[model samples]
Target: MKLMHVDASPKGAKSNSRMLSGQFVEMLRERIPALSVDYLDLAQDPPPHVSGDFARAIYTPEEERTPQMRALLEPSDAMCRRVLAADALLFAMPMYNWSMPSSFKAFLDLIVRGGVTYIAGPDGYAGQLARHKVLFLTTRGADLRDGSPFAGMDALTPALTHGFGFIGVRDPWFVDAQPLQFAQPEERAAGLARAQAELAMVADRWAADVMSEAA
Candidate 1:
């Protein structure tokens, strides 16, 4: 199996979400020895936003696209191709103002193309890609769980879940490193500890499942 691991945080190694995702990937590798992993670090090289010409080119028939249009469309095409090639996707994103980083949003725009990830058909909409498993790891500065003051304020999770679902990914696993901006050191420590424990649990579950399937 091939797994596409995408890290969208600009903090590099200091990113909590990246650490969580790395741990999960390690677990997957441990259980599924034959699995191949591809990593995409958006912070190092952010994808360009889609331009008007690119949109026009994608909507226009292939045979009629001008040279300028073709150039504009090439990057998005390549991004979508990479996404289509993967069997599973792992996104490590940090919540920025309750939403995903702009870099990650730009990457999403490049991949969600017509005739590539999804298509409009007689049935309304259909996803061209067959992959269904997605694992999302996020870090938030403030708590946003159910019934909390910030409840329903998690814009990134739902947005990403819907976006991936639009492209045929339905089985999504979400893990969060929450409330990083606690007023007390102990609160921050507690949050990090909880997140670590959750990561360990998720990794163990994933490992067990992979081994079971292999056996």
Candidate 2:
């Protein structure tokens, strides 16, 4: 099985999302010994923001694109290729200002190409990546769960869902560790534990599916 693991946290060792996602990846590795993982650290090598040249370049027919347009499209094309090649994708990020980090959004911008990742037809848009599954492992400083003061404030979840769904991923899974920064020590521990438990469950199910398919 091939998995693309993306880390958007700039905090390195101090990032909860990174830790949880890494552990989950390791869990999958344990279950699927031959699993191939392609890692992308957005903090270290982030995609450039989309520019006017890029917009024109994607629309331009490949055969007709100028050298400048091809150069401008290279990063986005590379990212799209990576996404297309992966059987599954795992995103590890910390929520920033009620949503995904800027770097992660930038990464999305590069990969969500029309002809590459999706097709726009008269019926609207059809995503090309329906064969791939996705998992988002996120950490938040605020309590955004049901009945909490920050309830429904999480724009990140829906954004991620629709963004990737636009390109064909369906029913992506999320494991969110929330309120870690402001919560009491025990509460933070509980949240982390909860996320870990969820991760284990998800990993088991995904690994089983992979093994079953292989058999």
Count clashing residue pairs per candidate: 0, 0
Candidates' C-alpha lDDT: 0.82, 0.91
C-alpha displacement of 120 in model 1, angstroms?
A: 2.0
Scored by Cα lDDT, where does model 1 land? 0.82
For 39-138, candidate 2 gives per-residue lDDT tens digits of: 9999999888878888889888889999999888888888899989999899999999999999999999898887789998999999998989789999
Native-to-model Cα distance after best TM-score fit, residue 99 in candidate 2, in Å = 0.7
Model 2 collision count: 0
Off by over 4 Å in 2: none
Give the TM-score of each candidate: 0.90, 0.96
CA lDDT, candidate 1, residue 22: 86
Residue 13 deviation, candidate 1, in Å? 2.3
